[model samples]
Target: MSELERRYHRLLRAYPAEYRRARGAEIVGTYLDLAGPERRWPSPADAADLLRGGLRQRLRAAGAADLIPGVRLAAVLAFFTATALAAVWSVLELHPPRAEWGVPNAGPFVSLGIGVWAAWLLAAVAHAVAPGRWTRRAVALALLSTVAVVPVAALAGLPRPPLFVLLPQVGLGLVALGLPDRLPASVRAAPLIAIAATGLASVNVLPRNDLFLSYYSWTASQILPGAAVVLLLVVLLLGAGLALRADHRGGWALLVLLTPVGLLFLRPLGGAVDGNMRGAPNPGWPVLAATAVVVCLAGPALLPLTIALRKRRRGPGPVASGDRCPTCGRTAERAP
Candidate 1:
């Protein structure tokens, strides 16, 4: 085989082995013919198209044809939620109360998290207006910055949020990485709108004393932190509802996306209830963590059963004995 044919075959590896065995040569031939003489290396467009087709075929074989659309919806929602939450948290961190405690001013430029969130925001904007390649590059940069900030912040002795809190940002970013190359204008604009609205709310709510010390305190008394939790829950639920209206695939994606959010809050909720953040070791942490794990998994686990039940209901229900069709009020025809 020539070098061009070899490369084409390699790209075909994206498909399942069985599919490759059945159709790989045909696909490679089509591309090879298109390449003509003196052509080496698949064009970017062809590579991307092949990869996408392979992924769809794989999903279809897995009986998950809806997964692509579901994942795309989840990615958009997760990205918006992550960026907005980051903005609120960043602003909340900047509230004046931290200054009295010698916490460094965490402006957009000075703080690791601020920088990370800024990268995410830029990526969101790029997803909205930039080409697919540029959007992907921007998203990759944002994810890298998010992951890198943890070690850097720790090394620098910067005050960081709890591990659970930090994890959702990373989780959401990973989900967001699957966002479709194209999106509706409203979908593209959502993150910016969420950031603007949440940022302003966080700024206005102003953290009460001791708010930062226990960020998950949901008491309306705590204002900023409380609003943050409420805002996150609302966004998550609304997005889940919208996605679920479409299909079970969205339900699965929502479950996947909610796992990190559960982790983000459960530790703090445990601590707040047990007064652990006041310095005592909370014995309830393990129990709370386990419960959270169960809760997160339960939704996804039940989804298949629910889908099965719906299918059963739709199958061959008893028809009225009026000898008429249910639709168009037409008389039913009897088979000989």
Candidate 2:
């Protein structure tokens, strides 16, 4: 199969397990059958058809609701678009001294703008393309990898590369290689560790003031602490989730408590350079305010990283129902 055709088939695994189980091989075979020869590349039309099929698989995996398959997707896309627009508008309009037209400081707005869009776009593509365990883990790695690259790029004045080009290539490669081991475990393992590494590395390399650059700007000291808090919260939450499934009320309750502190401390450092629009109306306020406003918004986004991690760790008891143990037709379970 051609590269596009191969990716198209991989995305099929993102649909619901039953759906994939029923149609996966058929989907792969269909691609192979249509391609004329396994070694031959797909025609442009064949490639387009498979691309649409891949998107359908991704959409199916996101949720089973039928109200409008595209609605949630539209909403998700609109959200990021609004985020990007708000950031850019704030910077350009409030370029400098207005400080009143909603621009606080172009710096915070800009950084937030970049962070929101980067997170949103990669996330959307991940959702669009991911059809199963391996792809998702690989996508999680890609995001962490992006976080890793940001600092390296910033500190080294590294060349900027197009993410659209990079994500699929890298994500596929990771899945092709490490995924054999990465998929069966939790989703967060790679991501949490990777984020932690990114955050930790920033301590020595990232500018202290950049922490204050308005994704809740903090000092470098605050960065590591905050990053640790994030790591802590994730572990607790995952452990709690598993614990809850195992009927460990105490563990769940304790884990719930960690959230406030983490929320109070955690920050999302996008590519912007300023803290807040202290002097301008940047998207800094909205993104940071949003992060602070709703505890749930980041839940799903973070969950991917969490699941990646959880997949690595032990699961909840038979109560962790979705993941049925193949051995006994029982769900993956953990000790309380």
Candidate 3:
């Protein structure tokens, strides 16, 4: 082989062995044809293209055969979200602005919380990078450990553990239980890095109270209505776009992302209504009403939009022919 051809073959190492075996020669031949005898090295563009294509193939292969795409997407998103939240919480617990909030000198409960987060983070990393039976086993063990420790800490008389403290851990455990034993490394890397970056940014930007306390509240006082409206609109638009693009799995993942936000409003709406009836100093009716409107509109609207888009994509009725329509199983003669 010429020097250029040799270098091209080395670059092909980016692709999986099976993919390379099937298409490597065809790709090499095309590159060689394009390069001609004069060229002695792979161009930067060629190297980049090969690398990108190889990474795409690797990710495509990472999907577990047993799980649907939606479930896999949800699992990855949940893991990343859980990891980020746990990291932030751990940081806050260790370094609270107030001495009362700081658990730096606490007993097993503090250790348990921090240790579980570390374990969960490691489990996610292992599942992403070394997906196998062993990885699944490790995840299962970590989840079990988390479950076991939480109640034990409570029984040991740690201050009434906050609802937020348990909720993320429990949610993550459930997601981990449902996830496939193996996942593609390529698919896992993006979410992992994104969560890490987000966690760091949030720790730096948000006040300790917002990170650790405000989320646990059931009132709208802590939430900004304008920001909430903007977020709701963004999520709705994103969901609509996903549906229109025929990305049902992605749409479902978006719903998973929105679930917590929806729940956040639910408690406050109820509290505000009850408080108003009793003449208490509640946040007021407008806050409750707006939350209700956003929650009601965002979820149900996506369904009809999705159905309409799908029907539109189906494109009128099946063509008239002697044979039956393969997809709808309706006879062609019966068509309008």
Candidate 4:
């Protein structure tokens, strides 16, 4: 094989073993036919295209043909969730019950300077109206801003939210990066309106209390933050249910992507219930961190099993005419 052919083969390694075995020669030949005689290596464009194609094919082979689309859809949902969480969390800093508990009374300039939540909301707006590349840039900036919170808070002597809380927001931002460059205008408008309505409802229904205190205390004390978390969970479940009805892959995508966020929220919520019942304090960050780690580890292991089980439940697709039967190895008969 020529140098170009060798390099192309290396790139094709991104594909599954079975796929390469069946079509590797044909793929390499096609590239070779397009290359000039003097070509010593695959062109940059060709290399990228091959890698992209390989990844897509691999996902299809794994029964996730809709993974990318589902991820894009999930990204939008995640972005909205992350933004709302950030908004609620941001308020905690502005109104700490004690002088030392948070940035207590820190003016909008200092408290909202970093504006992690606003960054995500702006990204959503960009995604709604901007070009694809610009939308990606906006999302990337929002993600970087979220990561910057820790160091920024440390340096400024500010008390940020717990690590468990921030970690999942980061995860959501990362997933939101999968959002398509250009979504329909309606898609963009709906999330913003939903967020607005959430804000209004929160303002009207919940009394004026220190959000931070409410979030950390027992169930009865945590009414406001708890309600917010529950509402967000309900929105996510509704999205997943609607997606599942339309396309199974979309529902699964939402579930998988939101798993970390759900784990984070559930721990605190569970701790609150237990704390209330036992007259104990809510679990600390350490316990929550442990739960996040375990979920991260178990997620990969459980996904394939879940997919396999789903496939088993679905059984096999209808055999087309001339397709060999799994049991008898006889071609299927045509419909009358």
Candidate 5:
């Protein structure tokens, strides 16, 4: 082999063994044909292209090449959002914003609850960085710890756990349940680091407030009707995007992302709206409608449609031979 060919072969090592076996020679031949006689090294563009192609093939082999980018985005959003909310909630519970930063007045149960959430967040980071059976096992254990701590704290007569504290843990558990079993490690690490950085900054720099109570208060009006409508619309659009790109499974995964918002919808809009507003009692119709539409599109409607479309595109089964039926694998009579 020429020097150029030898260098190309080394670069091709980025691809999986099976893929290299199947198409390596064809790819090498194409590259050699494109190169000049004096070429002895890969151009930067060629090296980059080979690396990109190799990563793509690896994702395909893992059965998540299509879903990794979307899932990674969703995971980062979930992690940072959860971490910020948890930190704010813990900070507020420990020291009221208007009051002095007193000693850590939160009881042992509160501390334990906070630790459980922290552990859950770390587990999510671990899974995102090194996804596999063992990382998944760690996530399961972390989820169980969060679940166990919540009930124990409640039973011990600690204050009712706030929504921010509970929502992220629940969402992580859902992600653990729904995420694909295998994913490329290259796709995992970047998002984990981004989430960790944002989480640290949010906890350290952001000021705490009664933000949780403001959102969850039964009598206090927190969000305006127009804002609620916009939020719901954004959720619906995100769900639709996931459905189109990753199909039904991805659509369903958005449910975890929207769970906290969905829970908020259960609260009466009348209490959260102005009394003199036009359709004050009924202005929330849009919110409810949007929620129902999103649920249908992301849940039942998308799954069946995807399945039907795939089946149609796949066509029908092959014809059965005399000894057996292809559809049911049963014995068939011989032709006369």
Candidate 6:
């Protein structure tokens, strides 16, 4: 190594000693390639900045970059903020969220805020406990869902969360259950399947005609639609919990797909009343309708965005390094 190379190696001492021991050559080699052969000695400040950037990148992967906590907090805030804001309208109008008006369901929306955040809480817990493919995907999905829910829910309210929430989870479950032996440690939560099953089973179990007639006014039962939504919420939590414990890949994936799909037919409007219907109860706000449209149409596309970001952060490893055999000591071992 020349004098410039020597100084660069010395500067690398600022990095973690063990990390330097393992990856020091590769990292320094990259910097050397960037700086080129005619390099001058790096100033103390330059050395410090390189070390800082490296450390920051590492921390972003391992530590504070866990966006779940922040997302959950935001969900919580959305819960209260939306509820409080809508409450003012309720007071002024002298009525709660009305199905006839086409507004979002206040109680369910607030309740769903809790449910959505709870699912995210489960995801964070899942990531903290396990860091495998399923757990990471679950965490990523929770974060993605959080980003999606904010504006969508702001418009849709709690009347019906989109069906996309837990639909993907069912696919995850099939995969998880298929390979019991190879299942990751985190996807072991036992209750997640039960929660999903309960959700799927309860879709139309609630006495629709009687209940719709009963609490259709004050309680807003008819507008609430199927129990699958609430069940999907539970599945989201339980699925995250399971993802943290056992392997249920296919099941979980399906569960994710189901969460949003369960609410497709559910419409808050009672009947037709567009521009000028004097008898029509102020046909709610279009936020609810617009939200439904967005969640249904936009949710699948949004999923890839989160997954892609994570993949970008975790770029492919060195060509040879990732191919090492776990069972054999031979670096050049053949695939099974």
Best-fitting candidate, scored by TM-score: 4
In candidate 5, the residue pairs with backbone N, CA or C atoms under 3 Å apart (3 or more residues apart, or in different chains) clash, namely none
The lDDT ranking, best first, is 1, 4, 3, 5, 6, 2
Top model number, lDDT: 1
- Find the 10 residues in a row with the least total lDDT in model 6: 81-90
lDDT by residue for model 6 (214-241), tens: 1234223232333335444544664466
Residue-wise C-alpha lDDT for candidate 2, range 200-263, written one tens digit per residue: 5644453443222232333322532343355445445644665455433223222223333334
RMSD in Å for model 6: 17.7
lDDT of each: 0.63, 0.38, 0.55, 0.62, 0.51, 0.40
| Deviation in Å, model 6, residue 106 alpha carbon | 32
Per-model clash counts, in order, read 0, 40, 1, 0, 0, 65
| C-alpha RMSD for every candidate | 8.8, 16.7, 15.7, 6.5, 16.3, 17.7
Model 5 C-alpha lDDT per residue in residues 164-242, reported as the tens digit of each score: 3353355545454434455567555644554556456645654444332322333112222222344346446766875
Q: Give the TM-score of candidate 1.
A: 0.66
In the range 231-326, model 4's lDDT, one tens digit per residue, is 456546766775554444445564556464555464665466557667566665555566667666765456667656655665554323443222
Instruction: Tell me the tens digit of each residue's lDDT in model 1 across 1-336.
Output: 999889888989888777888889999999988885988899998899889878765544544445566566667667777777777666755543345566453442335566776787788788778736687688789888878878988798764454455556766677778777776788778777888897887766755534452333442223323433754565567656755544345554555555555544555555565564355445265656664566457635664564455546545333223322211123345554
Q: Is candidate 4 or candidate 6 better by lDDT?
A: 4
User: Least accurate stretch of 10 residues (summed lDDT) in model 5?
Assistant: 218-227
* Candidate 2 local distance difference test against the native: 0.38
Name the lDDT of candidate 3: 0.55
Candidate 3 shows a clash count of 1
